[model samples]
Target: MHYCKEMLLIADEMRHFEGFSGALAVSNIEYMGTPNLREKQLSEFLIYSNEKEIVEQQQILFNTLWEKAIPAKQRIKEIELGIKREFAETIRDPTEIRKLFSKLLESAEKDILSISTPNTIKRIEKLGIINQIIKAANLGIKVRLLIDSHTFNEKINDKYGGELAQIKYHKLIKSLQSFVISMIVDESLLLVIDIKDESQENFEDSIGLATFTNIRSTLDIYLSLFEKGWHQSE
Candidate 1:
């Protein structure tokens, strides 16, 4: 009962945090699923105020997760004692996290939406995942993607490797990033996996992800991180 309650609280936190402009993939023109609270305008807990902080912030956060929260020994003790720990502190196994992520990708059978603010790095991030989504879509599933606020090749500059770094995804409906926020709905689930490595070779690098069987039960921290990243990029 506690676990289920915590899950629902997380989902609500995620939904109310990000100010997605409008329904880009699955909502009506007027109702954006992420809400309309801008970061600058709204007073909320901020993990990182800039996109450049992703690496350092995430690194430190993950590395000290156990220390910051209940220690692994404590977690195991609680579990052994039959106490309900909503999140198991010990990395006793990676299997649980991996399985959840797999299910997230697997759940696209109904509706899957990938929304990102257009930029060389983040756009490239979406490109790496889109093909998989498309393949999933072709299997009689519905898959839609949106990249917002992308301007021109000149914006990226050749110094950063030009189009080589900029154009990662083969296809997407490029437009104002703000207008694409609301399109995400009908999504019983959402996956916001940050590929930190940024190398085409080891695309398997996963920075973080929000995995859930029901979007209504996913943690809001995931969307909060997304909004944090999205705002920093802009």
Candidate 2:
């Protein structure tokens, strides 16, 4: 259906072509119409109020929304080109972090690079995340893992021998005191887990915070560090 003549005329005449750029206060609400008002019935209705109180309230709401909104042109361009919105999220819940990690691994198309402490590795192994990594490797995804040398022992070898064999690359580096697990998927997404208490064996209890991001600049910084560590690893 075409827009009403009044709306079309206003859109054409306004200096701010986008509705959001104008000073006009607009409120949208759902409405049910009676039989007498059936022609005006709409699942959603826009309201323009002349009362000072209502206008002030709506202006405040509009300002709040405006601050959060991006330019309409940018949004339109993103939609047209099918661009994924960039985001960085800090996930505190262990379950949610695990879910995000698994989802990223499952969606990996080319490669996976990971740096992990032995304790962190062991914890995730218990959570079945290690199995997912092994599966990705089996599917021909390039998987490179870096772990500390001191903790890389007979026990870890015994547990991960078959699984590690399937991975494309594995290296041992000097012992790191920090309890952390970092993984980059397809050179796009990064997941970093900070371990609060290494003494705790469970993934939930040990992890302090998890950061997930696909921001290009952040990915580049980490990727450089990963490459440096990877080249230096044995």
Candidate 3:
């Protein structure tokens, strides 16, 4: 999906959520006369000298957003707008979808939750959500973690210490029996990440960033589907 240049540019800096906390002051709003560049101009005008809040630990910050995150109604509005933006208009590039994702994350303070089934620890680190949750919680936001418990239980052995954890088990037939549960963190974000590798990987695509849609709703839907599967399992 594509996002307009206006939202994209603002999203570039907003991705880290460090420089801008995604707070809208609502005063001093200005719209440039330029027909196409208004959104970009709008973000530029909402400059607050003291708009910097440094967070050391992110979990607590993320957890804070759970109850304190953007109002669900507002978030739904943003989602609707985002979807509208993707469908009604034409965008120059798809990479701009990343920017839209950034915007969604920005507006979603307490409403954000990530559900992930990591094939490797490196993959989890690559997703960069660990820090995302950490930061969200640090800000008094709520975040739920719904990882496949069996992965934690069998794939990783905390007792064995560091290096021994990398043992690869190819035949995962036993993995059909996995743990699944819904955890509500401060009534904010509900994470629904799956642990079982029931679905096959599509190795046909080579592009890295291409896989990301930057749509949280899409991810949320996927998490829901995973949960449904877990519920129906015998």
Model 3 has a clash total of 32
Q: Candidate 3's residue-wise lDDT over 99-155, tens digit each? A: 433344445556443333434322333444334444555565644433454564454
lDDT per residue, candidate 2, 12-63, as tens digits? 3322123442234354432222222223454243344566676567667666
Q: For candidate 2, list the clashing residue pairs, or say none.
A: none
Best of the candidates, TM-score: 2
- Comparing 1 and 2 on lDDT, the stronger one: 2
> What is the Cα root-mean-square deviation between model 1 and the actual structure?
21.0
- Give each model a TM-score: 0.30, 0.69, 0.30
After TM-score superposition, the amount by which residue 168's alpha carbon in candidate 2 deviates from its true location, in angstroms, is 4.6
Report model 3's TM-score to 2 decimal places.
Answer: 0.30
- Steric clashes per prediction: 12, 0, 32
Candidate scoring better on lDDT of 2 and 3: 2
